[model samples]
Target: MSTLDAWTHGEHTHDGTTHPVYRRGTGPGVVVIHEIPGMTPEFLAFADEVVEAGFTVVLPHLFGTPGRPVGAGYVLDTVRRVCVSNEFTKLATGVTTPLAGWLRSLARELHAELGGPGVGALGMCFTGGFALAMMVDTAVVAPVLAQPSAPFPVGPTRSRDVNLSPEDLAVVKERAAGGCQVMGLRYRQDPAVGQRFETLAHELGDAFVRVEFPGRKHSTLTLHRQQEAVDRVLGFLDEKLRA
Candidate 1:
């Protein structure tokens, strides 16, 4: 069952673009990265728990699927949106992606508002590895990569890529060398994340902890639905944010 709590919704700006932000509670700040379907109710419910745990939560809806205010038939709409929302032709080639830049701008905004030097960041599923990339900024001190989607390359090579860009991986390596801990979770039966992705778990050395639930699958977030997991996440935030 979800916590079913309401969040204080607001908007923030970055790179001349505005993004939706849902938040509540008051204390240290934590950024909650959404999954594939964007900022759905379930994801917000999870953020609510983070707020209730006593930290202010900031969740960004990066992709502007504007005018989607209602959750009516959300499951189906989300499916179409995630799987095949756009069908336009690619007229141009090799356009530099803005994801990494946008993420950094968001980190700056949160750090400024929190009146702090560092803040916590979490990325889930499609956005899982994003948190690690955010560590490129020293302000992103504690990073959580939950059920991180396997980094797969596009096209023929098809080898499991860590998904993060080479430059960003270098940043993470630096953070790990500086003693920052990275934690992650994934289901045992998730075909999306194979032994290859496990290389990421090994790459972090002892700094990374991957917890496995034997019967769990890809949707571990919705499977166990454990209150204790939320507690542990909060504990992690408390430990990282306090000192």
Candidate 2:
């Protein structure tokens, strides 16, 4: 059986759209949204680590083939799909992906069931900013962005944009004012991340916790997984969701 086959599978429906969710572990909830190439082995492994750390972890499959390796061809294929998907806001600045509402709904449901302070969400790569968007729901207490590359990082505006519409961003800022902190990780030289960190700092102020590493590493929990980043995220989840 595939790795996902061993996990409890279900569909999270919101706004008439549904996506597959693979869940495991027990305790407070933590939703792990995968990158462009879907839930690869590395992503699953990272989710497993979150589970072992005592959170009921849910892995949502957004795009690409689950369990596939991140080869150049696989990456390109997934990129094509995401670039064309209406759920994503590729090449568009100052717009939050519509898919974030669905994700926030899922987080609300998870928190309702798990019964914690709230739930934790960690998004990597293409899905990274989704966690930030979900924060508008208030139930998402711990939102971690791992190399959040959205709006395609195409031009100057796209590069600096946080992908959150003004209204949604206002809500996120309000949440930050209420003591919610968002964590972000990226390599200093990763062009894909652009200047989102700077935007996040300006918007979130002291509530934005940025964890930066040196070199050109892209993925924080996979591909170029940084042990320190992983540990920091786990600790943040514990502090926000468990305590």
Candidate 3:
């Protein structure tokens, strides 16, 4: 049986856009947005870790085949689709993806149901910077970005972009100033991450928690599977959501 079979399946809609969402566990709510090439077994496993940690975890299927294993062809196909999807801001600088609105709505719904201080949001790879954008809503208190590779990091301009529009960035800055810390994980030598971490630091100041692993691995929590990174993510969620 597929790992997803254990979770409850549902759909979330916002502004007329709907997406499949898989949920499990029970406690504070956390939304785990999958990376490019869809929700692979490794991604589900990482979500399972969060579920085992005591929080209700929700995995939103953005693209690719569910339960699909990571492969070159799958990755390429998904990348092509996402690049043409208006829901994302692939190569755009200073603009929030339209999909973030739906994610924020999901976070709000989860927070409304769970009724904690707020909900946690984590995005990986192609969707990595999304969590930070979702912070525009107060419901998302704990936002984690894992190897955020947005705007494609093609040139110096896009490479350094944090993937938030001017207006949204202002609000994020306010939230950061108000003590909503944003956590980020990446490899120091990962070219895909570009200079966004530095941009985040400059934008959010100390409110941005930087966790850099050694060497050059793309996915910090999955594929690469760093135990230390996983532990830190869970610890951050626990500290922010459970506390």
lDDT of 2: 0.90
* Count of steric clashes across candidates, in order: 1, 0, 0
Q: Each prediction's Cα lDDT score? A: 0.64, 0.90, 0.93
Model 2 ranges with Cα > 4 A deviation: none
Tell me the tens digit of each residue's lDDT in model 2 across 38-141: 88888888888888899899888889888887899999988988888899888887789989989999999999998879999988888889999999898899
Global fold similarity of model 3 (TM-score):
0.98
RMSD of each: 4.7, 1.3, 0.9
> Residue 26 CA error for candidate 1 (Å)?
0.7
Which of the two candidates, 1 or 3, achieves a greater TM-score against the reference? 3
Report the C-alpha lDDT of model 3 over 105-209, residue by residue, as the tens digit: 999999999998999999998899999999999999999999999989998999899899999999999999999999999999999999999999999999999
**Best candidate, TM-score-wise?**
3
Model 1: per-residue Cα lDDT over 37-122, one tens digit each? 56655666677777887787887776424223324465456645544422210111121124556666777777888865478889
Distance from true position, residue 230, model 3, in Å? 0.4
The predicted structure with the larger lDDT, 1 or 2, is 2
Using all chains and alpha carbons, the TM-scores for the candidates as numbered come to 0.79, 0.97, 0.98
